[model samples]
Target: MDLELRHLKVVTAIAEAGSLTRAAIGLGLAQPALSAQLKRMERALGGELFVRGPRGVRPTELGELVLERARVLVPAVAELQEEARRFGRKRAAGQGQPARYRLGGTHGPLLGGLVDRLASACPGASVTTYTSWSTRELAGLLAEGRIDFVLTGVCGRSRPPSGGGGAALVWREVAVDPVFVMLPEGHVCAAREEVPLAELADACWTNVPGDGCFAQCFAAACARAGFTPEAVYETDTASCVHLVQVGRAVGLCRATFPPTPGLVTRALRGSPLMWRHVLGWHPDSPAARTAEAILAHTRAVHTRAAELSPSYARWRRGHRAAL
Candidate 1:
């Protein structure tokens, strides 16, 4: 079969993810299907592209060569698509064409408010939002000019991406959201004002299934508290919340998370666990021109949301300088 852009995308996704399972998930494909497709591509190209191991897959010499070409091709294709979209919009509406601003982020309390504010601020512009589990992937999209900006959280010593077209990206810290533990309302520690990380060492935890910044921070905090977290469930944000609500497992959440009816959020005692939320964009992009106002509005929205969380309010009282 002749090669296609989708095939190249799959190869790059697998290489970047370092595992077939992870690549499949990121691409929204089933593992077996992705594996079969990879095999077909290898046969068509007359050689295997990856060195498969029990832990993950790595690019072979041939794979690296192909991947380097794919990287350039894929981003160029994305740029073409973006330009085509602009052309279509202009042709369809003439001088009345609306400016389109694409925004991306993971789950966050201020997301809705931020989107609304952006729309209100640019009356003639259309705002679109995208969601992804990995901020790094979102950054790649920005570098490809697929999105205008992104708002995301980073944990531990994780820094934002700074390469390729993304080298022009500028980031501003909008807020510091302290982490909290979410437990079933009927759990033993649910009534406590604060729960010690060590106290929940034996409890089953619901964990996001990757080594992203948030997961790394969670693992590091658990290690410092003297135990590795026993993750009983690996899932997305919504599932994690459901698991906690049903008493199946405990989970971590940001201060601005809305209170769930069957779950209680408590501050982690003596722990400095927190995620820094940042608004990032290419400095030369049109969206960046209004970034200062957007950031100010985002900060105000997050501050109001954080105040709604009793635990965050208490923490903010002592750490006013950090905010």
Candidate 2:
């Protein structure tokens, strides 16, 4: 048999773990099965990769050479596989792919608002929404001609993802929103107009999973506030809300999240983290033809969502410069 990615992984695993038996356990394969596979691999490669001993196994000269290459190839192939999976999921979900007026977005309220406005504005066109937690994935889709536009947010001073293959994309600033925390209405900090990040040092947190650097920024903010944050859970939007409502954990959210019966969304004292909304499109795509109109509607929706949140609205009034 020719060497494949899995074979390369087997070689790497054996070298790292120091024995076929141990590697088998780590790989969740029976030792005998692992040995059989190793033998086949060695035969295909025309040499033994290990020297078995009472003390366990050590890499032979050929084994060391193979191990060196396998170490590099395995991780590179693993990265390739991961990227393929992300793109595949997004692609497979699109049966025939692009709609007349298609939009790709990360989780947010603006996407829905834009979809509605697009449908109303272009009465004869079809409006579709493609959602993912990855902004890069959206950029890739735009580059591949699978989507017409993208609406997403970046934390702090982060820039938008670039469309691959030198595709020029035009990104418009729609709104600036402060990241906020959600707490059970009965919590002590819930009564405050602004919750301090340091006060939540003992709190467990949750937020909708996103492929952004916000978690790093959050940790850095906590460091500045003189405390390391407790557990931060990653889950879907509904689960995040449930976690906060039941008091199992608190949540991080955009300032525009609407009020729920038993939970309160409060601004952080220092506005340590901020979310900036942006809409993007390939300048050559048909969507660019009307990007200006869509951007205006997106900004309007963002403003409306912020105004609906009492805490955020109050905070906005006092911190105009910060926003």
Candidate 3:
């Protein structure tokens, strides 16, 4: 069967918008033209592509399957166009430009440090950083060639994509940040050189709302300790340090918290206790090299940060002293 680019575009637009009229508006095409394109493509394939309803157009089982395949194929074609445009510019200039790398993560010190290391390592490379979003959204950006790599605190909820999602990206575990409970100097918890999860499970917590990454593990640890957190406030911003400083509430932060006034962080007691933040990328992207570079840089930064941080040094000294 023969097909055209318009056919794929129409299908993808409709799938994304879930309505032909909205799809037409999004694609800047007349509704009739868009409908005709879909109909012709369905006829050529000898089947109906979508079912129309009062609400909107819903993809049939076949349409849903075709749309999934088109999701991968369509973006790939667009990326090829973008790459070709860049390549043509390079050819015109007699010098290929350095590769661009896009990276983002949840708003936190760890991600901030990761971005710093990437910029330092890939000097002259294009870089973009974003904060506050889900990993799945990052995965979508990767598939579309909008971002090269993503480094975020691992939620431990990601399954290896199998059918549709699996085709789009791959995840690699880079480092697991030991869970450190941050407290103000002379706070009750600070009396202990090292605290146990069970010991602090009932502690009043300062949490970011809708944060499945750290929140999930925090909740699980509380459950394991037979108590839940007494969350006094919900926030999704980068104010954990400030909140802890004022003694508003205790919080858990990664190992990379830079020196701040009145803040002390210590690891929770347990073998292999920590939050694992992973790097993500589209496995088939042309920017995979750039992604790999960013990941390598991030790992080095994590190691170096842990080595240099006074909090980590104190932990090591305490552990050795106990031994």
**lDDT, model 2, position 132:** 93
How does each model score on TM-score?
0.74, 0.70, 0.64
Q: What C-alpha lDDT values do all the predictions have?
A: 0.78, 0.81, 0.67
Candidate 2 runs further than 4 Å off? 1-99
Between the candidate structures 1 and 2, which one is better when assessed by lDDT? 2
Error of 1 at 272 (Å): 3.6
Q: Which stretches of candidate 1 lie over 4 Å from their true place?
A: 1-47, 52-99, 120-124, 163-166, 209-211, 318-323
lDDT of 2: 0.81
Give the better candidate number (2 or 3) by TM-score: 2
The top-ranked prediction according to lDDT is 2
Per residue, candidate 2 scores C-alpha lDDT tens digits across 1-323 of 97876577678888888988899766655687689889999899899889999988999999989888987886685567446545654664565333377789988777887787778877877888899987867876776567878999888778777754355678888988889999999999999999889999899999876656787799899899998877989988889999999999999999998878889999998789999899888765545657787788888888888898899999999988876
Q: Give the local distance difference test score of model 3.
A: 0.67
- Candidate 3 ranges with C-alpha deviation above 4 Å: 1-97, 156-166, 209-214, 271-273, 316-323
Give the lDDT ranking, best first: 2, 1, 3
RMSD, model 2, all Cα superposed? 10.7
